[model samples]
Target: MEIDRLTVRFGELTAVHDLTLNSDCGEVLALLGPNGAGKTTTVETLEGFLSPTSGTVRVAGHDPVADHDLVMARLGVMLQSCRLYSAITPLEALRLFASYYRRALDPAPLLERVGLTHRRAIAWRKLSGGEQQRLALALALVGRPDVVILDEPTSGLDVEGRLLVRRIVAELRQSGTCVLLTSHELSEVEKMADRVAIIDGGRLRAVGTPAELAAADRRPEIRFSAPAHLDRAALASHLDATVTQPEPGRFILALEPTPAAIAELTVWLAERNIALSDLSTGVASLEDVFLRLTGEHQPEAKGPGQTP
Candidate 1:
């Protein structure tokens, strides 16, 4: 799958801007961004639901819009909204979708793989949100697609549901299917994705593997929870580096968290009689990289109802 210099516009609003990305078979490339970041628009173009205003998007070496039927045959999509009929049961829904593909997996084994065997007989409207999500995944896999797009696969899922999805993703990777995943679950993305593309304001910001992105910002730092409204300037002066409170009572010191730096921080807190809690040292996290890249105060992962 490839998107080369892709741009999509909705009249006065530009939803995507010269975005270029590609995914090879047997890779999970995650598209990470807050709401309104053009993730849905990009995916829609790839699915042939929307045409690019300029540039190109291709799935299986065919232009999605011009060759919509051929692209749909090889591409499986699970959008944020469930696409199954309300009255349809999981088993029935999978069978119906499977019939569309010339080569398809059996509904029974697909149901079991997604841990929906117990709920296979339940009506789509009667199944829990997590159950419905798993069923959607099963439908996507029924076609044995060359590329699959999963939006918020783990949203509202329980621990067992999450584990089931993770296992299935692993199996898909082993089977050499290209997977494109979008989610707000940063920790999960860090675990499942081979590469992550962070975008904001309808433009690409950064793209790399979890470790590469984290290591991109080489500065190590200490994070601790303390009373809110502390004097940041004084702390910065003492540490001789930048000090930031990403959230109230949560502080980050942009200095190497070496033994000496840690000791100095402790002594400073001791002298000021400030209580400290939850102190730890680490390099940048995927979450930290996302926040820095997007500059969003609070990144909310929701369906792009407000997005153009």
Candidate 2:
């Protein structure tokens, strides 16, 4: 999929601004951003549910807006919200949806893959939040679509449910299905996504593998313990780094690059003969890079009629 300078506007407000990104076949590209950051709008456009105000969107070499039917045939979508027959059982629901596709996986195995086989006869309304999410995923996979778009697939899921979802995602990738997922779970994204795109304020900020983004803003971090009476200001002035006291006697430092910040700091501390405790240096994580780029340490605006 490729979106070139894609822009979407609602009245005078721009939901997506000049966004351009692409995903390779069979790869998972995660969209990371807070709510109202245009992640949903971008995905909706690619699914042919909404047309862009300007720019072009191509999915599987077909324009989604212009070739809605063709794109729909090869795509499976599990949106954040879906309406289903509350009275029907899980098996019945899957059968109903499977009937619409010319080629689909067997309903039984599909249910088992999603861990809903045991609840085949349970009413849809009787399932818990996590169960419902899993059912939604099963429905999306019913058609064996070449590309799958999942929005918040693991929301409200317990640890077990989350693990089930991750396993299913891995299986999808192994089968050569391109997966595009939108998620707020940083740990999940870090584990499953082959590449990640950070969107904020309706604009594309950065796109790369988790490691690439972390390396792009690479900084040496040091953690050490000091005496309660030790002057932090004096210690900070002596080292070539910025210090923060996360707790009494515990300091976290971001060292500036100058000839291997870690080595320099080691020499400086050694010169003072100050024995440090619990010191380590490493690159920033996807979560750290995301916080730095978007400045969203929490969720953003809720969708219409949805709770924040």
- Best TM-score among the predictions, by candidate number: 1
RMSD of 2: 8.2
C-alpha positional error of residue 230 in candidate 2 after TM-score superposition, expressed in Å? 15
All models, RMSD in angstroms: 6.4, 8.2
Best by lDDT: 1
Kindly provide the TM-score of model 2 when superposed on the true structure, using C-alpha atoms: 0.81
Q: Write the per-residue lDDT of candidate 2 for residues 1-308, one digit (tens) a residue.
A: 88999999999999999999988777999999978999999999999989989999988889987898788878888988866889899899999889878898899999998889899999989998888999999999998898999998889889998998899889889999889999999889999999999999999889999999988967766656765444555556666345655445555565554456667666766777776675645676687777768874432222233333
lDDT of 2 at 264: 66
Regions more than 4 Å wrong, model 2: 223-252, 256-280, 297-308
- Quantify all predictions' global Cα lDDT against the true fold: 0.87, 0.82
**Model 1 residue 127 lDDT score:** 92
TM-score of 1: 0.89
